[model samples]
Target: MSSAIAQLLDGKALSQRIQTHLIQQIQQLEPQKGRPPGLAVLMVGDNPASAAYVRNKERACTNVGIASFGKHFPTKTTQAELEQTIQALNEDDRVDGILVQLPLPPHLDAVALLNQIHPDKDADGLHPVNMGRLLRGEPGLRSCTPAGVMWMLQEYGINPKGKHAVVVGRSILVGKPQSLMLLEANATVTIAHSQTADLAAITRTADILIPAVGRPGLITADMVKPGAAVIDVGMNRVTEPDGKSRLVGDVDYDSVQAIAGYLTPVPGGVGPMTVAMLLKNTIESYERRI
Candidate 1:
């Protein structure tokens, strides 16, 4: 392992800067726009982690001068009822963005509900229209998590152009979008998943190794290329020896930090940037709507 410790990518600080900029922008425009930009986040179940994430998003919205119209429902909320609620929010003139919290109850038709959201108001950028826009390299709302990852990279001058980037995970939310974004930045990207043979071999070749597999400590020092930028997008709740839980990312920070040239930590890294991007998408949508 290299003795040089990786340069920390302070996502919390970058997110705070974005929040400050958004606050100024909103303050300057809200008066002529007749109201602040509004975002409505719809939550379906009582999943503790999901609840905490929603609360964080809502609080970020408030900090940036955006209005929040969030609602929580029991796990038993019906699909039709949720669809109706989305339709109502879609037509609400005051609302510029709408996002449904993920991991909905098993019975709920998550995809259909996501499709029901109007493209312009799809805050999470999970709607088909936005995803299509992203795929086509057209301007539209971006998926928050992936966008956060990109923003953090650019902030630190880690250009993806002409680099070999390996993304471990295929989920539409992070890994796929992340690869596309990196490709858009002119990076040659490779995606590895559970079935990929010799995962470490592929990861070791990456100039930028991003692991969003949600498996704590999946990527260790040996898996990383020396001087590579390791962006850990994974969020897993792992229990310590004392039975206390903590958030961790896919890369083994203790080991990888000493090997990688650049690294983003678990709790304060991509997580804060995700919320910052959510607020940004809302503000952008509001601008277009007004």
Candidate 2:
């Protein structure tokens, strides 16, 4: 095969297109419904990264005419207080979607707080009910990142059916649900984690490779099949020799791009799609209410 740089999946462009469409849909519905769709994002502490992410989500909501019911809590916020807040949002008719920012304060029980959200308002789709629906291939809100990956594949006409897909990382947030989605698309799926031995051997056999582990340079060029589609879901910030930090993915993009047939860029790939999917989920919940 002639070697060439891999084609980009271009999640950023696709996300923008999806958002534009969503804006029109919401506008047409808001006139009759009397209020725009609403999303409640609850964040705790002052993690710089989490703060930046919350801001992005809220900004996206504003851009699409969705109401933002964002609540920011101090680092010392208690689990009981957060639970009560979720209970309140659950009862609020104005709120259609509720999301609790991850990496909450140590004293707070994140899972318990998430469980308190009504399944219909679980905007992040991390609630157990939604996950179960995904496993059974039923209609329900889906986990945002995994759903975004599936949408990207469909947008590019990358059919996973009858292909071997190897997913690195088994976290519930991305890896596990991603594997399930791939399976639903008829791809033969293999999940590799820290305990898995001979990781490169498994990856090399894949027609589609997804590396979600947040380690820089984990998947080298040699580990990829020459013509495989490589989706890099890992987002890591590493300092350069000059002490300046920059974002990178799990795959070594420079080397892998030459070997792989298709590849996703670090910052512009899955990140924007995740946000786009979040907005989509919120609007879906809103539609259910009306």
Candidate 3:
């Protein structure tokens, strides 16, 4: 007997659709003589991952006709300097969205810098105002990864309403925000983290399981409920047998796929959707201004 294979959620293609839509909106906004929609990306330090992520965002901005303004601060930059940069971007009429890449230097106060961005221009959606809006069910830009995860579920026709959703990892970016979004969709949401006991037992009860924990292969086959839709948001790089590194998610893809009704692959799933949604948010910000 052959094992059932799970259907893949193609984030790359979905992102293309979002980018195309943004392009059309940008064309419509071009006739205006005033400031065009702009995204200011703040990179603090030389982290390879952050740099790569910023480059991808810049490329997405170009593809969607949004102007990109970038500020690179040395790793030794003071928190005040970062705050000043954000304030400048906030006051810049041409700038519509501001993103501060994560894993900032130890000396820098990430939250303080993030809070300095104008609430409306907080594209990464990490500001307290935006987070509050999400909690209150008020319309605002959501955290990119969580927003992408929700879009993936919606695009795949997996309505969370009345479903049991278990989200592992309670980080503000992915888990907590995602749980809120799921709750907004009327899903019974449970958030489990590193401290949660009997993690497998909690996960097995989920109709929709989302794992954003950075740990590789945290969610195994036994933890996955049969026919559940699993979205693995982790992208940890691990060395393979041949000694080359490969991107792997929290869920053990090979083991979980056999039991899952649908699954999103690492590197090709939530990652692409993030930038895509950023463009969407930028365009939406422009529309709101108009």
Instruction: Itemize residue pairs with steric clashes in candidate 1.
Output: none
lDDT of each residue in 1-290, candidate 3, tens digit only: 23989999999999999888878878888688365689999998999889999999998898788899988888888887788788888898788899999999888778888888888998888889999999999999889999999999999999999999999999988999999999999999999998999999999999999999999999999999899999989989899999999889998999989999999999899999999888887777777777
- Prediction 3 global C-alpha lDDT: 0.90
Residues 142-251 of candidate 2: C-alpha lDDT, one tens digit per residue: 99999999999899888999999999999989999999999999999999999999999999999999999999999999899998999999999999999999999999
Roughly what TM-score does model 1 have, to 2 decimal places? 0.99
Candidate 2 residue-wise lDDT at 213? 93
RMSD of every candidate to native, in Å, equals 0.8, 0.9, 1.2
Candidate 1 lDDT tens digits, 1-290: 55889999999999999999999999888988999999999998899999999999999988888999999999998998998999999999999999999989999988999999999998889888899999999999999999999999899999999999999999988989999999999999999999999999999999999999899999998999999999999999999999999999998999998889999999899999999999999999999987
How do the predictions measure up, each by TM-score?
Answer: 0.99, 0.98, 0.97
**lDDT, candidate 1, residue 156?**
97
Poorly placed runs, candidate 3 (over 4 Å):
33-35
lDDT of each: 0.93, 0.94, 0.90
For each predicted model, how many residue pairs clash, with residues at least 3 apart or on different chains?
0, 0, 0
